[model samples]
Target: MRRIKKTQIAEMLLEHQLITKEQLETAIAQQKTSDKKIGQILVDLGYVEENKFLELLARQLEIPFVDLKSYTLQPDLVKLLPEFYARHFRAIVLKREGDAYLIGMADPQNLLAYDEFERILKAKINTALIREDDLLTILDAMYRRSEEISHFAESLSAELKPSDIDIFSGTQDFSSDDMPVVNLLRSIFEDAVQINASDIHIEPGEKVLRIRLRVDGVLQEQIVEEKAITQALVQRVKLMSGLNIAEKRLPQDGRFSIKVKDKFLDVRVSTMPIQYGESVVMRLLDQSADILRLNQIGMPKEIFEYYSQLLTASYGLLLIVGPTGSGKTTTLYASLNELNKAEDKIITVEDPVEYRLPRINQVQVHSQIGLTFANVLRSVLRQDPDIIMIGELRDQETMEIALRSAMTGHLVLATLHTNDTISSMTRLLDMGAEGYLVASVLRAVIAQRLVRRICMKCITDATLSPPEITWLKSLKHNEYLNVNYKHGTGCTYCHRTGYLGRIGVYELLPMVPELADALRQQDSNKFQLLAEKQPLYRPLVLAGMDLATRGITTVQEIIRMSGEI
Candidate 1:
């Protein structure tokens, strides 16, 4: 393969109009003071897309462009290059042909890197271009945490005492000392954050203590063999969360903030007394991340416009319904972010305020002290609030207050635990809400579910089986059968699971006069029929199928998310 200088690459990009002359000059100026190369500076300054720039460079240099995320290296070959040298050179072994080794590099122009690799391997070398991001991601995955975690576990097992004495007692304070128990806990948390896991489970068995992380809505077990350190690990977590470390007979809950490397997270800790011991579950919430805007929440263009109209309405009740962990809170927060303005006064009453919004008054529900959602909402009404957000409609009193407030000219946005959009109406009515009042104030209902997205790095075309195609035809979804579909084949970037992240599938139901009349009449059959007739009323199953056809997800994900064929 041929190599080009940095100036030649920049000039080529400019000649193709990939970036403007002004952008090239700005990048050149920054390259003088920074250690990053001109191409790296241009990409960092958002002058061009990373993949596009890399593809252009590959074409210019006449070398293959390797996507390291999809490419897997043999364990033996990976051992040939030490991790220190590999990371320092930003390179990896791609393949071996006869006596020559093909290496993937982010910066193929680095002669020093080539010299160092040749000296270490003592073999003929070939070079290809790879994306910087892809190289870094593959590096982290190749060098996993199994070795470090096992080392921590071994150290803790050796240091632990047989007696049930609390090593982290007397004040819940932290020290800079290198305690094995503390190091084990820190590794667990850091791994969870690195994988974007939502929850961590620590369960003690009769012979072993198991650690599991919930990633992409599925639990993956970790490698921890030492059961002797269970108590010490539990005590350390309890101290950090401010829970009673001595009490193990009942359930308790607490929260704490942790900094894993540079990322800050808020972890909600809950403990329950199991037969073996106390089982702990921690829910990790990102505290340092910015709030997602409405447009960024993955809503379809038409639905987003419709939802925006509902938000702008002066007075009505808009309900977002879903099961637990269905991204209800995220959608609500995104909606609130769009409506957060100086002209409107917004107040939210939550059981435990999750994220703190600026310039918005938030209240936490304390039912033990008689300060419940109903009480807080009533107080909010008297304060003349323009918008009120209730975390969840738990009881009849809260639902009644929310209905009255919506009828009295205040835009009310709240969440409910229901399986679908149409069911939310009956859930409210079953909670003792009057039918006529509900029909008068209800504006719209949004039902949502989170489904795993296909890993783009390893995506390939997929064909549905006979049974799968028959099921889709039965549901009147014929358009999907002839379309080109895709799925991930599993790779290191996705933990060899064929999926990397999640996207929301949604269905919206707007309250028209015809449907409202059926709702007021308490006619379930007529209401169901009318709901099916509404243009905006698509079932969650069909919505998910749309995503599947578009290659954003897979057929299995649509079925798994809907729990139906």
Candidate 2:
């Protein structure tokens, strides 16, 4: 048998049927005008799987292959080379062998990377093949550690004193394209993902740049530095979001995607010019994240059944009322999963369509181009949709359209910014909608808010205060009579915040015949009285109190979120 050489690896794989000739040809073609190895190129262009190609390379080179993603490295050995070199070479120090180090390279064919590692460490090294993405992932994770982040941030931030950071125009002296600044931006995102932040806020303060992570519905300050808003960091993020990097005068909206630890997340970025600099807020929308079902959203079992029935109705206008970030969109998507049927024609007009559901038509509302909600909804009606979901009932025109659609044999689902379910009716009337029209077509209203769930890893018996017990009684919920609720005592798994995640506290009000008749009569005062009579109608505060009794959340949240309700 002939020994396979580095140059012949692609040809051998082609001949061995591991890859098609066209795939090999494409990889070879991409090889030119590219610094990547033929093996890395092949794996990148979907011509071959990363692990499989690594196996083929290992077999040809007569060396062991390791999935660096799962491979752990000694931190001491990893520091053998500067991080800049490690990132540039896409190489890592795997382990030490007697008097030598076993170095892993994404492209072992590149002796330059091996030479750099050997020279930097000043040690004899044995090389092996590793996946490009895996090595980079391991390297990034290593640098993104809390201590490393603090040290690196401190190093770059040394020159960023109070007087150095300018507001209107910061020092553009440092080129934004620098490698270290780019890595700093990536490190911030990776750390955000690790901490399960729903959103990342990069704000420029008068003296310090503050980096905050919105976790479990609360924003916690993470990294703060005097020289936080570097021109390079701003330019790097602007480029990623596809916004005009040159034009920092106005606010911009753009989206970009990121892959952290094999999980792909889509970030919705909005940059607003602040006094110090552009305040960048990135909302991480993980497409690969779990699409929770309605039952999983934390509605009381009694209210969930009624809410599900509301979705089953053939024709009615259902409204979800809450403040921003109350998980209203999540509940709407879960309801769509239940209603999206092949036989039913469902269409939605969203300002920014968040999810893609099969068998349903979703159109984005570009108001600047005149594709407003009312206009798109009017167009959707022409599509003969059986169910219509208007992302928001913002204007009187949209409300009128939705109500008319619901009356004409269409199920209209939308969200409204209202304090409670009853207030939604008043908001519609105040928005110039006809009282009788709203009353006739309205079926049900759902109000919700999010509360942090107790971290199971650190859950301990909670001793409720006498005042808290008395407040629970005011909620009129019997579930808390003698229950020994639990609370998180703060643990690493929950970031020492006593809560790992959040769940919804919901209130569902279904339209009964009495309320419907009263609404059609244009008597909202009577309708409110009738709505309060429903046996299943529990206010959001009461539902949160029930969760408090079960140890799912805290009573303090009930007061903080739904005290007014």
Candidate 3:
């Protein structure tokens, strides 16, 4: 496969006179603009039927042609690799022979896949040329093993005591029933991780304990057993996360790790004392979530290119502003990836080091031991780091250290809690940093919020409501008036919510001389005007609206995200 001459498809077509030279030239040109292979491009352009092209290519390459339309595939066989790896390599194990695997691949000519399959499956790979559509069809089936929750949700059938499972009742102890509780907690963790849920909430109510999972950004209610059982489950979770199971009267925080498949996720558990009982919430921090590049965040092309330019600056503080859970951490990591170099030293100090990046020294802040953000920033500066990332510009001391680092030489990246990019400058000033200091070293401010994306599987054409139509007329999108939006009515894939995943709606502001002058002079009114008039500036409201017009999200989400433009 490494020595495969992919030109065999073109040569075969020429030998059969299946396409004219002009048609071949046209198809090749199209291929340059697309990611499809030459055979797929030729078939797509109607130069040859897909089946015939695949068959001819198969014969030319001396590989078995697999028409999955009529082929039966076993889910267990295809699931030999994790869903992430399966989709990344676009190859799945069809069958195993001794130490070799018969792998289904769209293009049997790929040699890079051989090494990947060997590394993942720990075996050799034999090629079977499968239709691209067929390969994707079975990937969904293979991934269903993880995403389908009905399999492990049966753990809710256990019975329990009704009196809230008293921790200090003196006579009651959970040691005897620890095994069943452990199994139940493991089952709940498995179901949550499989569906890629961001957080799991188990709350105690007067009559029952409500268990819910926050998938994407929406919380989905789940069927629960009696209140008595949930009380036991709460104590079980506290025990697993190393919290004080004997103290339900006060709030607590703890963390634990769980392994699902070949990956491990850190679950941050917190319990808040409530009216009926202690309510538990678990936030899953998957390491793989932070490794995404910027384009995956769904930034508009203009905004993406603009932000990419800002990351190239050698010495300045670039801040992404948003509320907690609004994708600021992900944006910060993406920016760090842009600057990550082998020769240049990069160091980050975070309260809780979430994702471990390669070639970067990461420090976790322990405020309990006086190892705060300011303390760590001062120490990281002494390390002679070329670039530094402070997790948050939390207070005046941390801001002072970060600004000095940026003004001296290092490229600093951090996040702050603010509503907009312009507000970020004001926030820095409010944090007790000198106006001149902030104006001199600040590079760019990016404000963002997460909006759930419409599920592609269930999306259907949508008509504007009367209020929605009236609202659209007031926006700056006259050219987009004819645009048609879409929404998911409801589907199981999205847990009955119209949206499946989250994308960021952003507003970015680059520091210009005039804005710096305004900030330096402490003229808040002038600074506001200068910020609003910056060249090519798009506000968060407009960006979210553009996404709505293009059927990416709904208008309701826009109003909910940015509030009436």
Candidate 4:
């Protein structure tokens, strides 16, 4: 055992402020029962954070910290060592264990480096082939963790006391009515922000109120409470959102903002009268507007470039069709970012504007105030805007307005609730927009969906099973195209789900004369067939298959998204 120097121990005692002359004598007397090192003792006594202890060690030992992610172990070197030795070194062989070369390292004697490497790898390792920079990060993280632990320990050593509680609080003051509605609404929004929720739903029932948050496009139940409390909460939200708190009978809408951490979030609030009570839905928008770019939105480079060119054309309607929560807003935002210019006047009318962009005018649809999509769009056209973005063309009036706008020299971009690009025209026509108008003004319709991306860190090539191969053979494929299957192995980087980000499967319809003529004749099937015959034809199914072949998305996801190719 290494004996600690008296001078070093005294310095540590002084650093922690844990001793005086009398306390030093007491510590010396108690030393027999405490075998911990000076750093460990200081940490146990809550004098410093654990990282601080590691930093002290680093300073004393004069060694560098290392991180594992920056390390790239060579396989050839590890082949010479046994498994036990390799495991002891906290390193892994980069190549196959059986016939391939391997690389190994010695033990992780540097505590700071070891801690950071473990965090990056999410596992225990004695050695790693780290780059010079990563090694420095490891050392820094070790010192940081030590400092944090030391501070925590110090806080814990402080005395604890119980506070007295009133058994019977005043009923009048304790009631929910006593709290301001705005305060309650602030709490709800704060909670939503903390949980990274995209939407909040407040469902009013006969006897109770249900609150749920949509996180990552999935709705999750957060809480349920009494109807009275729920009503109070609703009023609170309405007040914060700037809606009519006193008027509960008629439907109302509002907008508000809340600051969470260092970010400000824009919140759109809507309330509708139901038989039981008022139901509310609030869409949360991240104020930063940090959306993935056109290429990062998951479309292939060629398809992305093709659409980019179409948007630049002087006059045409570009429709993006997809089901709700399929990332249509993100795609539209990306396109707007592409087209936005200081010289051009661009305006948008949305039911609830999801994001705020600089240099673009955004209008919110207020149905209760008789300001609808059609009404706002008609007014927007008069504003002399070069580009108009409608949230959705739901009704005949809005569809007509969108078509006319595109025909009258202004570009229109909007979303429609449709299954695919081919069906979007049918949906528009079904809404009573003329087929001729659609064919003349419609430039392109892009239908898309998001599918999970493969985990690159753990993804390994595996031979397709016989059944899988047979299934691939069943799909319709062009003679010119070859299909290959690939997938990922679950890893820590992807939360053990084998997938990280999502890729988009897009179906783009370009307006060719023959296809326009087919649409004009009400020959949608023929139009689709003729479009397929074109040399540049690539449907949604083909796009999905291409992504699957590249191992970016799974075949199952493609099949689910494109519906059996």
Q: How many residue pairs clash in each candidate?
A: 0, 1, 0, 32
Tens digits of lDDT, candidate 2, 299-376 = 777878877878888898999999888888998888888897889999989968887788989999898889999889
Please provide, for model 3 over 3-74, each residue's C-alpha lDDT reduced to its tens digit, 9 standing for 90 to 100.
Answer: 345576687798888777888899889888898777777788898888877776777777788765445455
- Show the lowest summed lDDT stretch of 10 residues, model 1: 165-174
Candidate 1: regions farther than 4 A off: 1-68, 71-139, 165-178
lDDT of each: 0.85, 0.78, 0.78, 0.65
Best by lDDT: 1
Best by TM-score: 1
Per-residue alpha-carbon lDDT of candidate 4 for residues 370-425, written as tens digits (9 for 90 to 100): 99999999899889999999999989999898899999999999999988877787
lDDT of 1 by residue, 1-565 (tens): 6879877989989988889999999998998899988887888999988788888999888888887666655655765888888888888888897898988888887888877888888998888898877767666765656556777988988865565433223232235433988778888888888889999999987777899999999898864678777777777888889998878878988899999978889899999888777899999988888999999989988789999989999899999999998999999999999889999999999977888899799998988899989999989998889999999999999999999999999999999999998888888879998889999999999999999999987999988888777777777756877888888877777876789999999999999999889989988789989999998888999999899989999988887886731
> For each candidate, what TM-score against the reference?
0.77, 0.71, 0.71, 0.61
Please give the lDDT score for candidate 1: 0.85
Rank the candidate models, highest TM-score first: 1, 3, 2, 4
**Clash pairs, model 3 backbone:** none
